[model samples]
Target: MTDLIEPDALLFNPFMPGFFEDPYPQYKMLRDEDPVQNHPLGFWFVSRFDDVSALLKAGLSVEVGNLAPGVMMDQLDSLGIEDGKHGVLNMSMLDRDPPDHTRLRSLVTKVFTRRAVAALEPKIVALVDAVLDRMAEKGSFDLVEELAFPLPFAVISEMLGMPPTDHARIRELSGTLVRSLEVVTDEEVARAIVNADIELAAITRDLIEWKRANPGDDLLTALIAAEHEGQVLNGDELVAQVVLLYVAGHETTVNLIANGVNALLRNPDQLALLRERPDLAGNAVEEFLRYDSPVQQTRRITTAPYTLRDKEIPAGTFVLACLGSANRDERFFGADAGELRIDRPEARHQVSFGAGPHHCLGAALARLEGQVAVSRLVQRFPDLAFDGQLEWNGRINLRGPAKFPVRAT
Candidate 1:
């Protein structure tokens, strides 16, 4: 007779420390057993590649925040969730749906186009080189702190015409602000987010006024001038979008460089292959994204009833599509889903950048950054390897190393 299953075995929760350390095995189990598992927290977790893809591509889908179907500010007040005593969230395009999302995205689409991102490649390479030179002097460093974190922050800030001196302050504000997305459920964290938001708003207001007066060639000035059908982003929208872009740009690319390096270190053979064939750096990035994505999951709300694997989900139900799990599904990626293959043929198939109308706007920039960072790191330190134990960031929504110590031996 088959072994009896535990009732709680099917429940998938990623909040635990153990899950942060390693979530793949559990992800596999979820994909194999309950591809459309429902969580006790009142959301469906979709793990299979096909199902996750379908749900994300669903035209009637709404932002996860809309799942509650009421004024979010009222909910925040009821829960005492004072995230920096600000009303910024409601003004954010990231949390909006339909006409609002369409309008906001259109305002900045020109700025994020592939051609625009390509024009910034020379600057990105110079920034990467400067960091690598500093690492070469020490012959060792915390990869995340010294290289991964600062590089993207510097690039994004430069694009906004932010002075290099203000980069550190912006980083601090961004770090605290992003936590609201991942840890808003915790009361203590909610308050920290509030402080960050207050500080961020002050800084952003100053910058907006400066850009308005100066009207330089930077992205901030360009955004200030950009309009769609003669409709431009208001002051609030501009600040919200700038904050979103600055934070989102750093968060993912930082993780990508750190996570991609960590993955290469773990798989020696793949590392060696990359060292020998630097041309594969582009493909290797895709593989790294597939193996351990930066963004683990994205939430959406059903606008209409939907069915998956015989499970019926009602309208307004929050759904969490497990992007990390779906990327490793054996059916789509073949049996070697767990291994790091630099030349994996279908690496681009991974949904690390997400999909559909709301797909990541910075996807191309992220790819270029990853390819350059990884390729140059291998070239700079052929003998690079772990210098100490790796530290997981403990973020349930985003996956990456908190501190990755490496030696340039």
Candidate 2:
């Protein structure tokens, strides 16, 4: 396959079918040939492990989101679009810089603490069991639809104290919004994204009102009352925060479990190793994160001129930190980086959940969900294996099987 492609071809061509199915080969080429290549479309692609790690630690100097004013405006112009969506975009700390980001994160931290997350273990376990039971009834199932998607979606929704009656609607809306991140050439996706954003905004607004009237011991209720320095989140802020949680919490863990299961099935040795020592479940989860990262790449805009790998990147430039490529970079994980090894000592060093202040806020919850789901699947179904052709989600940024058929004996 490597022989068929041009030696200098950049792996980021969204339309390239070969790159979408298996991008690691192209990523390896980028790491070796041009670790810090700037895209003609206007962004720096950082593929090497060391370079990605350094950029992550750069903190607020490198902000998240492609909508940063200068280059982002240029991008919009190039697309023949007008204006920006700051109202909705600013709500997510994942896309904000310091001050606003810090304040929003602090407000959210009051509710989404480690203890709060830890307390959900039993609930998560039960949810996992319930999901598996449904899968068992079928004997054969789409692991993603039955277990991966539902488990985390249910857990996160319950944590938010959303009414059970609205769970299906919220889940559907969140899925639509997340799918907007895919590399689609059609205007249908764009229209869907815009509509989903509008619908999510309305749904969250109503949820906030409901929580205000009937407060419960849930994250949403806590978020409603949460304040820092006597400053509380406004209505828009509240809606945005809820939407952020819904989007982030839903997709990442779904892909994590789905991707992890696929990795385990593909690497029988590691699966056997995990099956023998279930104690390695935690370590194995980390490897799954590194092996097939849920969130492939994250955007960071340069606030100031920054030097990375001897290349001086100017301010306002959008830099894509390729977490997927970095995770497989041979320099960090050694020559056997391409292979899945559950016992890899340095697997935790992976930036799958990212690093520094702007790192994923729901990392703890996602990790817990991944650990329980993957471990339970291995233990309960001793002969678990792929039952049919795997269907990739076809998203360049979020890689996972859309329909992973598996047989559990």
Candidate 3:
């Protein structure tokens, strides 16, 4: 006879701050004990790799019509997104299902092709070298603030055609917007929403005006010139797209670099392997993505009742896929699943960039940035070691070190 799960085992509360400190244990328990557990806060938590992968690949269909304003409101409130419906429009690619998603994604997909990203390798290496040169003189550095955060931010800023002078301003705005994503309380969420709306809207409007008057051979200019079947995006759409690329491109990459560096410091032998064989940078980036994904969780709502692993999920139910847990699931990754093995044979199968239609649009850029950043850091500072205790940003959805102090030898 099969073992029976208790009614209490069906729920897992993720809101607890303790989970943010070390959620892997809770995630393991959830995966082993209840793969399809529901939360009292009104969402089903899918922890196992297979279950989460199935739901992402097949269960809940993605359609713009199914994009609930309430769900967006909750997400926005959590992230402190304040441009109201305008922000939602910019995120249409992620929110919409096929046809719409297919149409929209095609427009910008060419810009991020593998060849394009590969071409950027030399430029990225140069940038990383420059940043490290400055850091070497200091002998001590905060990786997140000095290198990881700025490198990707600078790259995206250049791609968007933003002037170097405005990089600091853009970074500030992006930081605020990203923090808004983690604000849990209603009051804090409301404040974040208002701040983002006023600031981002103004920034977007200014950029649009500048792009119209002073066109350059850059992504923004390309976006402005882009026309599809005699249809062109208006100023609003252009601004939204720019903001989306600017924030999403750098914010997640920042975490990936920081998290990857931290993981390497914890594993000396793996760090040594990466430092010696920089060619492994590519696989190392994939391993980092799988080992500790920047994006920890993402949600989808069920439009129709579905049976997943014998558990009945009613229509309109919200499902949270714990990617962090799923990535480390032993069932998919053998016994030593938690270890950070740079040569892990099956690392590519991880869903850190997600799967199906809604896969991260910036996946190519992220990988390029990660490989460049990680390889260069090890090469630049051969004796780099943790200088102090790391401080992590207390966020459930986003996983990354807030500050990573290191001493260069």
Highest lDDT: which candidate? 2
lDDT string, candidate 2, 1-409, tens digits = 2333354566455455576568888788889988998766566789999999889888835444444322232233344433544236445777667787888889898889999999999999999988888777788999988999988888888999987557777777776777544433455555555566777787787777787899899998888777434566654877888898987887889999999999989889888999999999998888999989999987777878989978999988878889999999999999999999999999999999888778889999999999999999888888998999999887778788888899985
Q: Stretches of candidate 3 above 4 Å error?
A: 1-11, 15-17, 59-91, 179-183, 232-235
User: What C-alpha lDDT values do all the predictions have?
Assistant: 0.80, 0.80, 0.75
Q: Where is model 2 poorest over a 10-residue stretch in terms of lDDT? A: 68-77
Clashes of 1: 2
TM-score, predicted candidate 3 vs. hidden true structure: 0.88
- Which wins on lDDT, candidate 2 or candidate 3? 2
Models sorted by TM-score, best on top: 1, 2, 3
How many residue pairs clash per model?
2, 0, 5
lDDT of 1: 0.80
Q: Which segments of candidate 1 are over 4 A away from where they belong?
A: 1-8, 66-85, 227-229
In order, what is each prediction's RMSD in angstroms? 3.9, 3.7, 4.8
TM-score, per-candidate, Cα-based: 0.92, 0.91, 0.88
Candidate 3, 149-176: lDDT as tens digits:
8899888877777754566666776766
Best by TM-score: 1
lDDT of 1 at 188: 56
